[model samples]
Target: MSSTLAGAFGIAALFVAVLALVFAVQALRAQSGTAKAVTELAATPEPQQQAQAQAQPEAKPGTVKSELRRLSRELEEARTELRETLQHLAVVRYDAYGEMSGRLSWSMALLDDNGDGVVLTSINSRNDARSYAKEVKAFESDAKLSPEEEEAIDTLRKEASPTLGNPDHQ
Candidate 1:
């Protein structure tokens, strides 16, 4: 009876040892397989992500145009600010020779805040220094302006803004 019990206990220990060895081998194989997979991935060639990004589609013409328009608007605002910083502009309009004597002067000068603008025809010969203001907001319209007036306005426009590639940039 003692011999039988000892034999049974030995067989159980052997079985447990064999099972533990099998499990250890399986664990080692799993770890090795993971390492090999990582190595293979590292060895493969891959295109540069930046180069792939550059290969993407360019902006469409309409998108480009809209962007250009936005940039143009910003530039125009900058130019306006620069001009305001440097100089001023105005418009003047009045009758040159008034036949009516002693009439109230009807002269006006459209001017910037700094009072820089062209002097128009004298409203009245009676008053030499008196000047009025003109509305310059009508520059945008479908109607045509007087040739001389338009020319003067164009001259002011040319002088008011900076050139795109001006000497200042250089």
Candidate 2:
């Protein structure tokens, strides 16, 4: 019963707060003309009080087209540079054998904008360690790829640019 009474009081308080807010807004809206004039003046500067804005240099005729052409050229150059860079990389580390500890064996995939690049695998052993490289083209390999190598490729593909070779990869 006490809880129900408290809930009723809480609801009444909320209703009073909402009613007060509505009245406050109405009172502000019903202010005299002088108060609104003062508010407008406070919010905006007078004509003479306006600061002299720094003027941008006027563009010459045909400059818009030329500027657009220049920007397009620069964009193409950036895309070409990105295509040559190794943008996608994934490193997979695992234990080669039950005896092997610390998971030193690793396979890494290094791909460019296109899914064309190399996969490097290092097999570690207590006695001796060896590394191998395989070429990948269009997310595939002409030569057989190990399970680790395939995993490396798949990881890089999923995490790399969704549009692999597109200009918007960046």
Candidate 3:
């Protein structure tokens, strides 16, 4: 009986040892997993995460508001650079007297903000009222106009409507 009791105790100790070893192994694996997660997090860049955060939402419709604000800044820059309206060219064609052959008149207006531009025009029928327009965009008083005319016209924008008034549209 004494020998049998001694054997049972030894078996229990062996079982306990195995259980302890398993527990230790599990603990090591858990620790390693935690360490791996920490290392990966540290490897990431703060600025990249921030940039991605800004970039992802910038594509959304909600960010359209923000985009409009940015557009306003760009539009302001373009307007500031407009010197002479002729630096940009706009043409208007319409019937001068409302009837006669193919057409009546062609008028081209070039202008910047503050409604400063000229109209070079021809009318088939004589009229007292000439073509009129509003200031669409203006150049600063001191800025020199560039000889490249296309860039000047490209900067002129149509006036904004209520629905189209979103700065991004301009």
| Number of the predicted model whose TM-score against the real structure is largest | 2
Q: What's model 1's TM-score?
A: 0.25
Q: If the candidates were sorted by their lDDT against the true structure, best first, what order would they fall in?
A: 2, 3, 1
Assess the local accuracy of residue 48 in candidate 1 as a C-alpha lDDT between 0 and 100: 45
Q: What is the C-alpha lDDT of each candidate?
A: 0.48, 0.77, 0.50
TM-scores of all candidate predictions against the true structure: 0.25, 0.55, 0.28
How many steric overlaps does candidate 2 have?
0
Query: lDDT by residue for model 2 over 35-141, one digit each (tens)?
Result: 65445434654332233112334335454433443454577688788887777899999999889899999999999878899999999999999999999997788
Better of 1 and 3 by lDDT: 3
lDDT of 1 by residue, 21-40 (tens): 99999989877865674554
Candidate 3 per-residue C-alpha lDDT over 53-114 given as tens digits, one digit per residue, 9 for 90 to 100: 46655534544344443554466677555432245455555666765545555655466444
Off by over 4 Å in 3: 47-170
Alpha carbon lDDT at 6, candidate 3: 100
Candidate 2: worst 10 consecutive residues by lDDT?
Answer: 47-56
Poorly placed runs, candidate 2 (over 4 Å) = 1-72, 167-170
In candidate 2 the C-alpha lDDT for residue 79 amounts to 72
Alpha-carbon error at 18 in model 3, in Å?
0.6
